[model samples]
Target: MAEFLSLAEAVRRTLRDGDTVAFEGFTHLIPHAAAHETIRQGIKDLALIRMTPDIIYDQMIGMGLARKVVFSYAGNPGVGLLRRMRDAIENAYPRAIDTVEHSHSAMAQAYEAGAAGLPLAVFRGYKGADLPKVNPDIRFVTCPFTGEQLAAVPAHRPDVTVIHAQKASRKGDVLIEGIIGVQKEAALAAKRVLVTVEEVVPDFRGLHPNLCILPHWTIDAIAVVPGGAHPSYTHGYYARDNKAYLEWDGISADREAFAAWMRDNVLTVGPEIFAERVKGL
Candidate 1:
């Protein structure tokens, strides 16, 4: 049931202002192209969700597209801080964005709970952690069988979940291999799923059957975007661009530099350029 479309069309059709969008990827296979397309299309007021929000979310926050962010970690990967996000939070530069923080375990459990159609995720966490003092969402529930207490948080059911995968069969089934993180659960938790892949093949018959595969029926749209996860790497295809990550600290340190960089790089380019950018990676 997945419709194969261009990245621009897929993003425009599935993403909108005020939507809760989760660009789920771990250290690898980050959906940079889809996020770039969303930025190019000027979608705003998004509630962004991720377990680890790296450069992509920083770019979105820098562009002033996000009104809220739900995440466990925010950084530039190996780099120091997400300067743009810090600016928005501390100084309200482009706009004041709200933040809801959680532990890595809680986020993963929340996504799993959503995929399971549960209202909340319950787990043993936050024991002696000060996170509960600040994050009111971290509450406690008593076990029925035992007198033990468990931590609970609302499940994350995003409006759209976008991810970059290594390949997709012509039938629309997606293949993601390397550090998948919560991509699967996030996709299942969302109302709509949009995927970008490095290539589209006739079928995945020769690949390992036990590999992580999302059936065609689960996705709404797919875009063949080679190098779509640029700077983040695509496992068997290329390595992560560590230089870019290092440079981001300087590029995003100032508001003007960040805006100019986005204007020149993101706003001026189309998704097609991603394929070219990955050359020699």
Candidate 2:
């Protein structure tokens, strides 16, 4: 059964140093607050997994909280390269991080395979791509049936998978609307699941169908955290903070400035302030 808990307690109880963690949510509901909490708690050496690596993963890598990153495309979305990520990989400033590159389909299939309790994700990808030259995990397998070449990668079964959603019922069921990505699959594949939601209502009365709903049994803990997905939009609750993303390029350019900004804005602050982001609620 899912228990209602504070974000601090949830992160403390669910995550640990050197664990494989996946803070998943493609474009929307990016779980920014949870990532900040992970940094504040000082969790280190995590193997972070996600399809599209964005600002949150960049922050974790910048803080040296991650040892390895497994993803397809990595960037600041519409912006340029993730400066801190680039620094870690190129300059090895904070630390030299390892990377496992894959295509979008490969990662998505890996999540599905993990959820299905499979050891490998076999798919058709990486044809004429140079990723295989760098990542040995991208192996070639011949299908016994058709003899067609298929790529195989290890399943991404994270120790814990964290995601942000719009609402949760008091009964502990979570509701996710707008852009649904690999959240449900990741949660199912993980050993433990942590969800942060904007609000907890008595019942999901007016919510539309076709939305991703995780029953209480599937969730370990649920945190009521409005604006938890800052800098990323949470569908009807808020809009993406374009200025923040743009400003991050400058703030994270230098190591000292990045540490200073995180110390002042993120470390000093808590999830309570995030509620202010969704006014008139």
Please tell me which predicted candidate would have the highest TM-score against the true structure: 1
TM-score of 1: 0.99
> Positional deviation of 210 in candidate 1, in angstroms?
1.2
- Model 1: residues >4 Å from true position, as ranges? none
- CA error at residue 82 for candidate 2, angstroms: 0.8
Model 2 regions lying over 4 Å from their true place: 278-281
Model 2: which residue pairs collide? none
Q: Per-prediction TM-score, please?
A: 0.99, 0.96
Assess candidate 1 and give its lDDT.
0.93
Instruction: Give per-residue CA lDDT, model 1, range 1-281, as digits (tens).
Output: 79999889999899988999999999999999999999999999999999999989999998899999999999998878999999999989689999999999999999999999999999999999999998999999999999799999999999999999999999999999978899999999999999999999999988888899999999999999999999899999988989989989999998888889898889998887888888997
lDDT of 2: 0.91
For candidate 2, write residues 86-118 as lDDT tens digits. 999998868989989888999999999999999
